[model samples]
Target chain A: MRLDKRAGLSPERCFNRPGLMKTDYRSRERRRRAAWIAFLIVPPMAMMLTFVVWPLLVALSSAFYRWEGMAQGEFVGLQNFSDVLFGDHFAALTWRAFRHNLFVFFALFVVQNTAGFLLAWFIYREPFGFRFHRIAIFMPVILSTVLVGFLWKLFLDPNFGLINQLLEMIGLGGLRQPWLGQETTALPALVMANAWHWVGFPALVYLAGMQRIPREILEAAKLDGCSGWQMLTRVVWPLVAPSTTITLTLLFIGAFNWFELPYIMAGLDGSPYGSTDVLGLYFYRTAFGNQSGGLQDFGHGNALAVLMFMFIAVVATLITQYLRRREIAL
Target chain B: MTAKAQSPDPLFPRSSPGSLIAAALLVGNSVLMLYPIVIMVFSAFKTTGEIFDAPFSIPDFTYVANFTRIWGETSLPGYFINSVIITGSSLALILLLGTMGAYALARYDFPGNSAIFMFFLAGLMLPLKLAVIPLFLQMRDFGLLDTRFGLILIYTAMGLPSTIFIMTGFLRTLPTELEEAARIDGASEPRIMLSIMLPLSVPPMVISAIQNAVPTWNDFFFPLVFIQTDARKTLPQGLSVFMGEYTTDWGMLFAGLTIAALPLTIIYIVMSRQFIRGMTAGAVK
Candidate 1:
């Protein structure tokens, strides 16, 4: 019936003769539907085209040009890209930020995703007070990243902070170095705070996936004398491949887009000797100068932005495709 | 099936050591999660000196000095009002324009139907911040810089893709009988959409609202870039500035942070189930 309507063939067409009035009515209805579709779809399409698509194209094109502030200078094909990739000052910063982004991606995968899966597994077991646990775990995920970042920044203060005070009380004061103040621990500390904030998201996703598993399959696995570890690795893990795909893809995008947390916790320059800098901070600093009197260079900034965008897009696509294939195979 | 006779539930073995261990782990994790926010609230009620002396102790509940100072001294209330305006307007546009687009895509089968749908879907993968340079320039040319309306437009564009995505998915699942009946009754298309279909789409609308509201309310990136005036700044950016000024006064800063976070935290607590469902709805399916 839907197909017939789309083809402009009403049910009355079969019984009635091929009359002019019928054709006129059908055409009029078609015109009305067309008008409605245009009216409905045009505004959003225009908005997207104006804001998202247009700027995207501009960013793509502007990267190859010499930009002095906002004004576009003469076209310098790939000069900006070369500078961003291999210049004296920017090359080191670029690689450092890139490495930091990779480090964050892996750290979050190991710490956050693993913790989330474990939490999901616990909830799936339906232990006593699981309902309360579910809500409590996700509490931090709802708060703004700024709030989480500030809260952790305060907690990690070397003096008069919760972590340090607790450490002294428990006779572990020596271990309480400034978490965000040092080079080695700064990035990891930011990652830990982020993990604390977002681990609940993946937990909920994994829980939803786990709940969809047929009970009979689990019962059968148990009846087969599958050990607990074997059951988890062989049965549950493979079944939740799709959920893993979702979580990992989002994690990758989020890792590369790591801005607000690091920005808030460790200042815009990714302070503590630039240990916490990521591509996001780099792009922002390049485009708009920091408090340290760095000059804004839109040319290099656009180049970096383009590179980040392409890298994320390509890797995310590949990750999603690979995981989806794995899901299909499993 | 035969295992059911010996064990009532083979999938979940209760009262085991492993279950006890899992419960303990969960409780520990919950404590780790809740402890910091609790400390923040506690510190908000204490003076800076008191906070330094007893970081862990609960403060006097009657202390309203921090709250009064923040209310009277800072521009946080203005920031809060600005956030309300920006988020509310952005949300309205996101829903209205998103629903219209989704309805058209789901209900109609015009030429380029799939193309337009894919166009919206592509917005999901490309983070808009990458285009900030061009967007900044465009906003300036359009005379929208430093304006709340500019932020609203940006947010609406940012939000519409997901809103349309979720709404379209939900609208497609709805049986077409109601629409068909309305059409047969000679009702206009807008009437059919508003009266018949829109009412049935409350679930997706709510989901989209919550999903979009959190980000719109919490976003500091755009406002930081576009909104230069202190009066126009939203909560996150405003709190960042407040933190900078009152770095020495931990109590006032905590009070400001608490004020920024309290509304959403309360809403989340009250409607946590819906919040979870809304947030995770996109990923689960």
Candidate 2:
């Protein structure tokens, strides 16, 4: 890097030096550079490969083999994948779980993002008590999902719960059904719990993005007599699209792979007629024996995991590309 | 009408009637959001009968009975210690390795630099749970299953991508003249990074630390599958099982939840600015 002639270590100086000396200097410099690169790259790269990348590769391969919890297993050659995709009970279970995931996804998309967008809009203005509001909204994000699930379970308790009690107080007791106990309401109930837990995140992100838009453009739009709706639709919305992209991309992955809240709220087996079953819980159940079944099939588990991985990898890439392109165009 | 929402001083000093309505609605909504947690904390101090009697009443602050019971009876203290160990160790490793990688990538152009950047960035939204099936098997093979050290390694590895991404972005924005001067004055690359860059990189370090640490602490899934023993369980996993077993014990459960949440809640309140800044750093950038 030191090209100046006045420098102590110049390429020209090294080249002009005597043969063995020049070779020694060049070799030493090369070695030092190599060491710097190696020191930086080796640890992080190795860890990612060993723990993350390599494990996924192993999962992909394992999906092809029939293995229980054992050191030795039979090679089944895509049988697991076929079974997961088309086999009788497993296939039905997979699709049923898939549909629930879609419902969860749709609910979160509408509830979380819309609420987030609205909250961010007001908070972005730095209105009175905005800081308090922001803190209040984001507080849940840091709590353990276990606690969130448990708290909501208490809140949704049919007999002694807050939601039902509030309904009774408001003379709408008839509208209050068993939120988590029935088939029709269980998935939505789980989704509502999840939305309650995570709604603040997208709001914060959106607020941050909105903060980045130049104040001049906003003022200029006001001067041009642009309505507030126009200001949002034409200006703020376009500018905050990146945050939208980020939120939706996360939603894409999380909704399909949703687990913890449902697991805690419902159970491992997606009790209440499997209404709250998601790929994550279902995959875990398939891999490990649950109350309904006593079979722990590693091959099928790996296959399901691989399917999830593929779906996320593909959809995540597509959404990113699509959103990023829109960002550039805007 | 609010003064700021439409005041038109090039700052959108919103002053519209709609803005007031929106603001009021926002506050109401935020209150609704916070209502449950409020109930939880208040309920902890209430007797089961009192909880049923006046569900949302202010708690009797003098009553330490529920907390005392939880502290004396439960294994929550052990789980707290376990969580601290796991989160702390993982954060330390993630920062160390992440910053090292970022420094190298930022300073020198290597083969596959962009490719490597893409590889790490791709981890941003990857559902790591998908890899759990094999990660478990691998951990089993390595005798890492049900161990704190195992959780630490996996978490450090898992968080590396986002940590590196944030750090690398931060490092790139810093002026290179200082590094150049250090090199000319006979400082080695590691020395330059450690002595100069590391201190300069503190803000991003804090951000990534919070980013990495919070999730690692709150993570229930990894510990759920990895750990088999109640003695070795992290807080979230342990709390889940504990809550299931103590379903009818509302006061103890709330007390336990409060205990589990207290440390993080305190940290956030104390460092609210930094916490907010750290959490929003990624999205804003």
Best by lDDT: 1
Task: Return the top candidate by TM-score.
Answer: 1
lDDT of 2 by residue, B138-253 (tens): 89889998899999998999899989999999999989899999878767676778898889889899999998888899999999889988889999998987787778878888
True contacts kept of each: 0.70, 0.61
- Please give the lDDT score for candidate 1: 0.90
Worst 10 residues of 1 chain A by lDDT: A1-10
Worst 10 residues of 2 chain B by lDDT: B1-10
The reply for model 2, stretches above 4 Å from the true place, is A1-20, A328-330, B1-15
lDDT by residue (tens digit), candidate 1, B121-224: 99877799999999999999999999999999999999999999999999998898988997776567888899899999998999999999999999989998
Q: Give Cα distance to truth, residue A151, candidate 2, Å.
A: 0.4
The CAPRI quality class of candidate 1 comes to: medium
Tell me the lDDT of model 2 at B34: 81
lDDT (10s digit) by residue, model 2, range A109-177: 899987898888888766667778888888888787888998888888888888898898889999887
